[model samples]
Target: MSEPYEYWLLDLDGTLVDVEWDYVRDVFDTVGDRLDRPFTDAEAETLWHGLTGSRNRQLDAWNVDPERFWTTFHDVEDPQTRAESTYLYDDAAFVAGLDEPVGLVTHCQSFLTEPILDHLDIRDWFDAVCCCTDETGWKPDPEPVEGVITDLDVETTEGTGVLAGDGACDVGAAWNAGLDAIHVDRHGPHQRGHCVRGDYRVDSFDELDLP
Candidate 1:
């Protein structure tokens, strides 16, 4: 960004860390088995990365019950196995050096997110962490972002803040909350199927043009 931001909020899953393909496949397989349908590799990738756009929309198109699929996914995933497979993106280490306050706003639930943070020894990096639940109203709704900023006690309205993430919902959440957004395009547009607009867009954290 050309201007300075007072604080930062970031998405956790695809933005900062990603589980290995083997783990990704295993989780999807379990979900598929429970749902009584098979998911091809392409389908799994699209859902896992939310490459096409809204995950619920994708699930709806597949005739899968969004609530049921999520319940099964969470139940099938082993926290320890997920932590073991998860690896932090090298570029994401940039967050550790940020002088401003940083918080996490992720759709990855707490049970899974906690272990990943603990395993990476990065739990202390964020002043606050908001794991979106049904009550928090998921991203694209400003509620969860509002919750995190409240937790961080960061200046609202007057302070410049930005949320960076690998998904369109992250950008939506930022914009909805009246904050700037950084679209971390981990997957190229070709793979993501469409580009997500943001105040700033970069392929890696190292590419952020912040002051």
Candidate 2:
């Protein structure tokens, strides 16, 4: 954008920070063992990174029990450990400097997200943190983002707002909510297996030329 947004919404994991491969593999290993179905590395990557686009859709295709898997995932996930494993991207530092109202609208639940934000010491960067859930709906649904918008208390006219993230779901949510989307492509096309279209696409926040 030529100018800064009136208000901004951001995704958490993948967009700001990500857990290590060892952690990802470890989590899946535990979940798979419990499910009695080990996941291949490709499957793990696809699910973890949303490379296939929608994790729920992928799980459905594989006949995985969504409720059971998520429940197990929640049970096995260690908030402190995941938070300790998370690291902020170098380019993502600019978000802390943003002058306008900023909100976090993410699929990361509060149990995990709170620890991660505290771990990174970036909790103060957001005016509102809307952790997506059954009630609020996930990204690409626009409901959670709208909840964050309500929390930020910003009036938006067309083209004056934006949401940035590292997923197609983020783009969908942005457009669906009538805001501009900034697609931060952390994983290259070859790795992700496809491109995520958006009003703006970048590999790094350094490319935004924020001032």
lDDT (0 to 1) per candidate: 0.91, 0.91
Measured with C-alpha atoms, the lDDT of residue 21 in candidate 2 is 89
lDDT of 2 at 168: 95
Each candidate structure's count of clashing pairs = 0, 0
lDDT of 1 by residue, 106-186 (tens): 999999999999999999889999999999989989999999999989898743889999989999999999899989998
Pairs with backbone N, CA or C atoms under 3 Å apart (clashes), candidate 2: none
**What value of lDDT does candidate 2 attain over all alpha carbons?**
0.91
* Candidate 1 deviant stretches above 4 angstroms: 209-211
Question: Per-residue lDDT tens digits of candidate 2, residues 1-211?
Answer: 4956898899988998998989999999999999999999889888888887888888999999888988998999999999999999998898888898999998888999999999899999999999888899988998988888888999878988999999999999999998999999998798887888899999998898888
